[model samples]
Structure formats: C-alpha cells, structure tokens
Target: MNSMPKYLLMALALISLIACKTSQVSTTPSPAAGMFKVAILYPNGDDKTFDMDYYEKKHMPMVAGHLGSNLKFYEIDKGTAGRTPADKVPFVAIGYFYISDVAEYNKAIAQNRDAIIGDIKNYTNIQPVINISEIRQVVGNNTK
Candidate 1:
C-alpha cells in the first residue's frame, strides 16, 4: 500500500479543519460562495524568525506560479502587534490563497510538493498552521 506523502498529508489535515470559513479580507467582494481557501499561519514565538522580505518577494510568487490558474488569488498578512500593546503576536505572517478547485490544488501539490516544502527553510523554521476552507459569506464592506 502506498501512503500519502508527508507534506500532502499535512495539507489535507489542515484543509479539513475549516471547510467553511472566510480567511481573506478585501473590498473586492467575496469570490462567490464555496470558494476553496487555503490559509497558512506562521505562529509567532519568542525565538522564531520569519523573513518577511523573502516571503513577500520570492516565496509567494513561486507558490503562485506553481499553483497556476487554479489559484484565484492570494493575500499575505504581516503581524505588527498583538491584541494589546503588552501581548505577544499570534503569528509572524499569514498567507492565504483562494483556490478554484481542491482537486487541482491537490494535483499541483503532488507534482511540486518537494519544491514547495523545501523552500520553507529559506524564510522561517516555524511550522505553519495550514487551513483549507470554503468561503461561507462576506460581511462588512465586502458584501454586495
């Protein structure tokens, strides 16, 4: 029996957690209901280092290229401060991509898993929390 690759397995696990939640915040209005969303959260800590420059400039573009047309779009959130001035930051950075199809995403991941997984070391050592979800609704200024 062939077991799933470690990276793919982890992605599947994270995707199952929030299959119906919105992770993107924008004025472009929601990209229709049931949109597949992938969110990667890099949890912050006392000794962690996340190279924002590399992530924003290099890694994400590589991801987008690999994701190709199935990737509707993506967003990145850089942590500035916590809930309050004295609190610790929850995450160093968060990367979210609105995928057009889950199956295609999986297929792409299967082919490029090594390249994607291997690039993590260039930016941060922290294991990111991945969430694959669906957009249920859009509230606030984003709603139609």
Candidate 2:
C-alpha cells in the first residue's frame, strides 16, 4: 500500500521527462517591466522524486487561486536535460511566478503557507531552491 504512491510518483515523473524532449525550443513573452519573478527550482537527486501530473493539474492551480490577482503569470517547466551532453539534469522541475506586488504576494503566501507546504509531499520530496528577483531585461520575441 505504501509503495503505491511512490510508484505513481515515479511513473508521473518518467512520463513528464519523456514528453519534454530536450531538442525542442519554447518561448514565452518577456516579463513586463518591473514585474517581480519568483523561481522555484526542484533540484534533482538520487533519492528525490517528483510527480509532475499532480503539480501541474492540482497544486499549481491551487496556488494560483490562493495568490489571486497578485500573480500575473506562472509556468511549470519540466527539466529535460542539462546544458552539456554529459551533465545530469540539474532540476527535476521549476515553477516560475511573475507577480505585481511583493507585499501582497508575501501576504498571500503567508496566509496559504500551510496548505501550500502540506501539498508538497503529494508531488515531490526535494526541497526547492527559491529565488525572487526583479525583471531587469527582455531580449526575445515578446510573444507566446
């Protein structure tokens, strides 16, 4: 019984990784001026596992709902490969959020922290590396 969740998690992870082909290129509109960026990177590890299906279908939507209007945009990226051919996939996945108000975002996160943190176990076991930054530049096609 205990193994069932683990098996499902593993299967979801494998399917996600396989579906995101490394050779493909994707583009998103450049962040608007002054937007704050929040990056949540789930580093890969020997024992770490992630269920992308749960994260994409359930967890992220829940978070967006919790965040409400403060969150302008968000994306969930499945790590396919590293920069070099020999390098390992650095992160299992990454969640990116573009927000308008830092204070409001913080407040929302604080209010929903328990529910958000509690759901982590359903999708992933790794601790994510989080970075909040100011969008400084935009150079690519500003289109989706």
Candidates in order: C-alpha RMSD to true structure: 20.4, 17.1
- The runs of at least 3 residues in candidate 2 whose Cα sits more than 4 Å from the true structure, single-residue gaps closed, are 1-30, 141-144
TM-score for candidate 2, please give it.
0.76
lDDT of 1 by residue, 51-97 (tens): 99999999999988988988888899999899999988899899988
Per-residue lDDT of model 2, residues 1-144, tens digit only: 999999999999998888887747787645887899999999998999999999999999999898898888899899999999898999999999899888998999999999999999999999989999988776767798
How many pairs of residues collide in each model?
0, 0
Pairs of colliding residues, candidate 2: none
lDDT of 2 at 7: 98
Of the candidates shown, which would achieve the greatest lDDT relative to the real structure?
2
Q: Which model scores highest in TM-score?
A: 2
